[model samples]
Target: MEGNDLQRDGVARVLLWGAVLLAVAAGMRYGLLENGLLPRDCLAPGSPVAPCAFKTALVQSFLHQRLGWVSLVLGGLAFATAGRRLAWAGWLSGLSGLILYSYEPAAVGAMLALLVLARPRGEQRH
Candidate 1:
């Protein structure tokens, strides 16, 4: 039972850290784009950034600019706590990150972290 708990905790740690790394990467990309180091319309088909383009500049800008920070905090909280409510919150945060930036790795890591945290202990299995 102790070993199982330890393993679960280890898994949780990995998930949390992975989420943080992904968040950081996403944030870095945002920073680059904002600074003009990278083209903002790279995701768009043509230049001049048409307002109706897929995932319009406005929406993409909002999501890309903010989701990373939100995910970072939520993922860190999920890592530090084991409460069920917090786990759910982490799931929500991850989903938002996924939607806003389509950052699968960060979102998936956060969701998995929540799952691990929310799982019943081995003692409860019986």
Candidate 2:
């Protein structure tokens, strides 16, 4: 039916968006950071270069497991509420956290987000 098609479309969109986010995160973590494409001086304090500043910000985000905690919190909220937006946010955050060296809580968060996302559209509503 039309409703089923709509549901499928929504799910597909969410999945596609998540995939794109994951790919970008992987590129930033591996191609740039792990691959050492970024010079060490790029991360130094008070870097004047714009690109270095952006890269440094990305690097700092994963430090101290901050991304993992953020992913966990967002995933928990999405699980508790089953809101589409929250679920998408949690899924994206989880994927990024996992790729950026925050796998522990990120794994749990990703699982929670997947669970919410897998539920039937009708059941997603409170």
Candidate 3:
């Protein structure tokens, strides 16, 4: 399959913007938690500080931090190259964002974007 430069550039932009948005969202979430603008535990009764148990919170925090970084890196690479193979990597990274970080919407959006960006095999320009 042969893809044109315009198609590649458009897909790359989508992936790049999606990646940037995901990173920004993660950072904003962290900032909100740090400043107490958002409650740590939504399940807890009113305004309790750090209501979540130590172990669960720790694991979740670790996962989110790691997945967020991984997603950013993968997204950046996809944006830089826009290779057809990188679409697969982007899908996996987006899945990690969904599973590990609980960023369902952004992860899903990235997944869809990657899917659209992937060029089909055996396609002919003519």
Top candidate on TM-score is: 2
Q: Lowest-scoring 10 consecutive residues by lDDT in candidate 2?
A: 1-10
For every model shown, the clashing-pair count is 0, 0, 0
Report residue 22 deviation for candidate 1 (angstroms).
Answer: 19
Better of 1 and 2 by TM-score: 2
- Cα RMSD, each candidate: 8.5, 3.2, 9.0
Q: For candidate 1, which ten residues in a row score worst on lDDT? A: 49-58
Using all chains and alpha carbons, the TM-scores for the candidates as numbered come to 0.38, 0.81, 0.36
- lDDT of each residue in 25-83, candidate 3, tens digit only: 45545654455655555665664555445434535643645554554556556555654
Q: Which stretches of candidate 3 lie over 4 Å from their true place?
A: 1-64, 102-117, 120-126
lDDT per residue (tens digit) for residues 10-93 in model 2: 677767877898899989988988787766686467755876777778878889878888888888998988866777777888
Q: Residue 18's C-alpha lDDT in candidate 3? A: 54
**Full-model lDDT for every candidate:** 0.53, 0.80, 0.52
Report the poorest 10 consecutive residues by lDDT, candidate 3: 116-125
